[model samples]
Target: MSFMIPSAIKISSQFDAGNIEVLDLTNPQDIQLSIRKDNQSDFFQWFHFRVQGAANQPLTLRVLNAGQAAYVDGWPDYRAVASYDRETWFRVDTAYEADTGELVIQHTPAQNSIYFAYFAPYTWEQHLDLIAQAQQSALCEVHDIGTTLDGYDLNLLKISKPTESEAPAKKQIWVTARQHPGETMAEWCAEGFIARLLDEDDALAQSILEQAEFYVVPNMNPDGSIRGHLRTNACGANLNREWETPTAERSPEVLAVRSLMQQTGVDLFLDLHGDEALPCNFIAGQEGAPHLPDTILAQEDRFKQDLAQINPDFQLERGYPPGKFGPETFTIAAFWVGREFNCPSMTLEMPFKDYDNRPDADFGWSPERSIKLGESMLYPIHQWLQADL
Candidate 1:
């Protein structure tokens, strides 16, 4: 009988809530949002905002700058996540008015405080929890290869059978994410991969642990990821670019991960990522890597073709223009291990926007889809790793 109409909060494109100030909230039901462009840089894809005091009202928040945002194309069919406790994020109905360049979101808050993001964020705390949880698994081993400039551990998680045996038949598989810290969906994909690999009912998982060892670095840029940055490390260095020649001063994450990859010898490697421009899920390979062997190229193509058949969400329609090995297109996924190891390595890019071919505004290319992709990868990989294949 008594409903409380709490106040509202403004939104912005900036990360830290302090740098940009709020304008109005009195009209909570009809709120407006704006994006503040980075004056020193041309980046404006990141957004973080808060809504205060709207405890019980169904707030219809509108971001009028959606169409003008740096990657305006990413908003057409998307759902934004919101949380009453910042710990649990669920999607809300969001429609992008293409003609008006507006993003309209509707949500009714249960508490005075609320938080939202492009996806359910896997915060730094969650990363630490993942490390701790994996360490406790009998099939899991934790190795600290090196430390970042910030003194944080450059972590590596090795998962395999626990029995004592000299011949660990487990084929070596490696997965790393967050080379670009702002692409949080990468980590979500990693989460799904690790979860499926650890599932008890998963016979494929059981066989994988017995026949192959998995090395995962779920968060490669913890400092940048935690600092709410779109890309680059704490010192503003992009880790992906530093892979070919990683140094402690600039990029210890790549250094540690690459060192382990060489030691174990990567049979299969997947670098998870999110693309701002591309609206479809696809795989980018090292076909252009100078003198890439015929066998590895075949494996890469086979894997993509198989995944497309398994999941309708993934397609090979659009992706980065293929480039020959050179400084211009040097990426961790393209040139580093693929060239150095001469193995079947790839970069699996999910879209920040929904999978256009089969769009679901309620979910989009979301945490759920990321997880499914992780699961679907196992089948193709298993088939490829077969002795005959």
Candidate 2:
């Protein structure tokens, strides 16, 4: 009698933003794993990697530290994503066992090589392509701002009126995303923003460029991004928190960008991120910024109104509560910039889960929608700049 032998299963996370610490594995049903903390930091949540050699096997991978993750609420009713070809990602059955603090993933792989992620990954190669696409435009200028701790080039794009013009730009506008490397949607949205800005046919792009210079940093933490860390950089420093006193050794990414912002000076800014617990797209500002004049506050309101008119995805209704009145905490990028520049600044967040208001069963708050939201932002930006100029 001949007996069939199933091959040994192999798992790997040796690529960009990949994170998974396997605990125990026999058959698929009791595969145990834990999310690795970001470098030296205790923060953990994002996970992505590949599984192979076990096809057509029913698997139940359990996250051992589910309750200990940064956002435990993100697991309940949240489905994990899987891919066979890496081009198309679909949700797999997922549930959280609160009593055991386990996030269980149920899947039966159709192919030997299958991948899983907390969400669809937006990779570094794609980011380079985005930068290249922007550079194709004469209005776009690429800047190698600084070096990351891991030695990856920190890039920034500047788009505005041609330098041949006699007068300099009237305003300096800044937009940076992906300070938390796991918030991949932020860069996807930035891609849309870059595309819309470079489109020669877009009147809003042209108008906005005529009035202001844009400094767009698509990926703020390349080290954390490529390492798949949730919130910290190569040495475990949170870039957002380091804004107050960024050092070249620990947070060169922030130090470089902040230095440039100091040189150009910020008239307005937007810091983009993804929120695990929230299922909506919204904006948060530092109302606690010192002596925020009512005029600037009114501008914030008007800009939000314009945003609502422009993009159906954005809402001002649900967001982080205002910080109680106090001295500005420069630890937060938005608060630091709002206080320092006294400009209209905001922290824009997109949900990691499905947008509950307009849910998509097949694909949750997807990369495509995030990109579209980025494109739509041009309207409010153009309108706001027009009024000011």
Writing each residue's lDDT as its tens digit, candidate 2 over 176-280 gives: 999999998999899999899888898878877878889999999989999999889999998888888999989999999889999999999999899888889
Local distance difference test scores for all models: 0.74, 0.87
Best by TM-score: 2
Give me the displacement of residue 99 in model 1, in angstroms. 9.1
Q: Candidate 2's error at 381, in angstroms?
A: 0.3
Candidate 1, residue 135: the lDDT equals: 80
The lDDT, on a scale of 0 to 1, for candidate 1 is 0.74
Per-candidate count of clashing residue pairs (backbone under 3 Å): 4, 2
**By TM-score, how accurate is candidate 1?**
0.83
Candidate 2, after superposition: displacement of residue 4 in Å?
11
TM, every model: 0.83, 0.95
- The 10-residue segment with the lowest total lDDT in model 1: 12-21
